[model samples]
Target: MHVTAADGWRLPAGPVRRWTLRPAAVGEPVVLSVNQRNHLAGVVAGQPSVWLAADLPAGSVPGIEAPTDLLDGLLARHAALRTAVAPGDGTGAVLHAPDGLVWVEDDVVRAGTSSDATSAVRDLLDRACHPLAPGPPVAAALVGAGAAARFVLAGDHLVLDAWSVALLASELGTPRALPAAPAFPALAARWAAEPALPPDDARLHAWLAFLDGLDQALPTFPLDLGTAPGERFPQRTLVVPFLDAATVAALDDLGRPEGASAYAAVLLALGRAVRAQRDEPAATALPLLVPVGTRRTEEERATVGWCTTTVPLVVAATDDLRATGERLRAALALGSVPLDQVLGSLPRPLRRTRADVFMVSWIDYRRLPTVPAGTNHVSNVTEADDVQLWLSRTDAGVAVRARIPDHPPAVAVVTALLERWVAEVALLLR
Candidate 1:
């Protein structure tokens, strides 16, 4: 296989070194968690590239000379990295722990001449972004030499989450016999048997009503992608560093007094931008998919798996920025119920397809305790069908990345939307 870089450089895909991780002792079969099941459903629904990748921080890199040896040691210590998925016997999917789990442990091909680190990392990440192989569902590679060296880890979202990536990076070399964390199987069983409390019921009902009120077909970005009906849409990403440090601080200060959050502000700006772009009526409600995490406890946070689901947030085009922010905060507060429970409560027709909704997800890299120093940036690449906007805080300031279908019209629509969002954000900050 050959991968062409964005700069028109072609990289020859070399043979990958593979390994099988064997469990020290055979254990009982583990059941798939609700989060894992959700990921499987996403894959079936056409969102195939549900993988996460991150650059290993300089401080976190192992002192060992060989990248393969370092990764082997890291995998041997982390049980979660050794996990895979298997078909259940007349039951649902089960978490498979093979005696020997196969994996793409390492891949390295020396360049004829010394290559710049940036180009090398870009090519390596392009390859890493591909779908995970059958068993183990994770792969790692090290490319370049000396100052230009880069370490990459790619994993199936079914078995890994953002928190898991940070944990793995932080604990790479320093192995310790910490107390065993609750595995996904145990969490799945607990969630299955647990009844929804009164609060959970309230959240579920609110979500159902929200979904019922939404149009059968929600408003989409105005773009004629020229795609055939029922054809799979290819996705393209556009990233822009919209906010500087001073502006971010100003926005934070402005929202602090009103109990508004950065996330609420972003959503409000997005809603306004979409309204302006489409010239929709003031009464029109724009539905935005917002992801909520299920790992509330310390123990749950330590465990690694897909523990998130997207809920609907309807933004009214008529509302003022403050009102919109307040309403969004309230809606999110009421949407604390687990996604699986919410789905089970909804009727078949009312349940929304995961891929059809527009999404706005925020990640604050500064808040992650396990994130190592010199961590430059982080981004998620998924082949989702809908327009997805990812907002994250990097060392520079606020960064926004939009993923839409890979067509000229779609790109133009998203580009205009992003520009309008930036302008709206500026107006709000003033």
Candidate 2:
């Protein structure tokens, strides 16, 4: 949220320098998370990476000759960078990486203007930060110098989750003030060793029942997205204003009596919008892929790594708002078990058949650490078959962001869907 590079900051006029890093000593290889393995399963050569970019305020890095000075400390602080996933046929071990900016002068290119430099740095990240490959899973670059410096930190989902990306963005904007926590490689090893439940376990049985209910297919868009089977289209995003703070409070208040939350209310509204349009009068539940935060303790909260797992939430619709909310409350406990374990317990073919997953994730920044205003998340051009919805509640209010395949029909239909969702939510207030 600091003044941008354009506001009185200077872009480096000299030849822009570069630094590449390797691990000083190797750590033990760890198994990739199920999310990581699946995300890497899609990577191909020349794939534009999924990434995050930020603009650090003026004088954020005083006495620093280059952004590398800041990058070096960041590299040390977050160990997820040091674990590189070897690209093969979908499955591989995360090999230990050589330590920080130890290598100098990989190459330097000269750019005359800020725009040119920005493009060059972006390309650099796209090359270095590829996922499911035999190279660094993380890379960072900076444009401009001194007060006007901005950075682009790119990595695959394997090593960097949304929470990790947000924390990294905040750190780049401010100096490295947080204390060091446990390294990710060690934590990952311990996590990999955790015992999985047998097939007869109650949690496994509940998940199995849900999966059996899903049959073999995942939830598709209620309306056509104008794409062919397995066809990939460039991603597009739309951010639409949702409920205001007062409305959110009212919804929560209404649900509180039923031991339900505003989240459950919104889920019910989402289900109604989706099913009502599809004209499935008998449909009573909607299953959403939910990203559950896996950070086990407060100390691990600030540590930068992929501390999240994806689980399914079957949002059931009922006559009483109380019943729907209570159902959601009980379902959240299922996330405490790791998703890989759930998938591992299932038949292998079932996992391979599902693609272009339909997921809806909700994150409330108001509950976590404070972030500077104007600090936004950035992503890259990629192909997708389904629309992914992220509902984020900030101090400004609740807003739902949708990433859909960029097409005229999609824009039109999705606009209608969100509008309906808003209207459905408004009914709960009445």
Candidate 3:
């Protein structure tokens, strides 16, 4: 395979060399993700590229090869999956950084039952999904054996985000070239070199000042779901789906009066649910953190990283749901705030407090490729949970993903909470 840079820049063409990061210390609580506003979006800073290793039971699935050809196709199809910087992309080299490419690493492990296979897969995913690490960006990985054989892909957030995970799943097992997408290095150079990017505005400056006062990085914030210690990582997810087209139209109509969006309504509902789960005063304002995609330009959409900002809605217990929804609307209106600056403004202590940061994030990815005609896709499992909530938009309508800190009571939990939240929000709007 060969690559010719569109802009006439010559790139290295050679066989790949690999290295391993030996464990230096024990009990290192990996920073799996950063606050929405932080530069590291759900990844650790400085380490460009994350390694996603999937442990599969030793067996042969139809149409799959041991050293998969699909893997090669994926890398060749997406340049971001193959290239890496020699020194890394950070500070000065940020402009030339690639979206970090993707590579597959393989290892074999002892056989286990279906349950073990599933658990092992989840464990590797959680362990490898570190908060956005800085670079030399390379979304490649080294795979190896553990409880089972694993395949890992390490890449930087500078080129991708969480939603891309679904895409990874889609590409895996069945690698094929996608229509040409934007290149990461080009976008990075443009962003870094552009003179017109608005300087830190007044609001941005004030927020930064606030963050300067509190730089105390504290213990990792645990999502308290009130589960037995062992149950902390419940192999359950709340699955939710969107409302019908008619219902979605109704929501758009209702939103016209106060400029509320289907997203705002979802936030209001999630805030209410979180309040109901806790003993806090109803009047206490619960801030719902909504993630706004900053990939606004045609070219920007294709590039990734922590390009999302948090829009906070302070929901009052006494406020009617509509009123809360309006507040969300107003907050979303002022969506130009830079997320990095916002995180920088938070007193380091408060910023790291999981308890203080309980909120909701809105994700919309309907415009990208759709799930293939007959693929099995799952939705949110429940309507409510204890703490953090996620509302995502799809061509169908709105969906949800809520994270509860053991305070709320429920049974038979699963992974489609966001889907259900989207359904009801559309219902209320309509």
Candidate with maximal lDDT: 2
Give candidate 1 regions above 4 Å deviation: 1-27, 42-47, 57-60, 66-78, 87-108, 111-134, 173-180, 197-200, 215-229, 281-284, 348-354, 373-384
Q: For residues 45-112, could you state the per-residue lDDT of candidate 2 as single tens digits?
A: 33344644443432443434566667766776777766676445555655553352253434666778
State how far residue 370 of model 3 sits from its true place (Å): 1.5
Q: lDDT tens string, model 1, 1-430?
A: 0111123222223322223232343345566666666566655555554556445533357553565566555555445565654433222443444335434433344455433433454544444443233345566655444444445565666667666666666655344544555575576667667767564466677777776666333334333444444544656777677777777787778878777777677777777777787743443567767776667788776676666666677877666657777777766675456666665565665434334457777767666545555433343444545577767775567787677767677777788778988898898877
Better structure of 1 and 2 per lDDT: 2
Per-residue lDDT for 1-430 in model 3, tens only?
Answer: 0001111111122222222221212221111113321334222343222332221221211234334444444444444443322222322222221223233343432324544443333333333333322222333322224323333333344335444433544455344445545544444444435333245466555334433433432222122344543233322333345455566567667766766666555556544544444455343455445556655676555443434555554556456556767676666654566454455455443434431244566655566434332222222122222345455566666554444433344332222333344444644654
* Residue 57, candidate 1: alpha-carbon lDDT: 37
Whole-model alpha-carbon lDDT for candidate 1: 0.58
Model 2 clashing residue pairs (backbone): 22-98, 22-99, 23-97, 23-98, 23-99, 24-99
Weakest lDDT window of 10 consecutive positions for candidate 1: 1-10
**Which residue window of length 10 is worst by lDDT in model 3?**
1-10
Give stretches of model 2 more than 4 Å off: 1-28, 44-49, 53-65, 86-118, 132-134, 144-149, 173-177, 351-354
Best by TM-score: 2
TM-score of structure candidate 3 = 0.56
Query: Between candidates 2 and 3, which one is better according to TM-score?
Result: 2
lDDT of each: 0.58, 0.65, 0.40
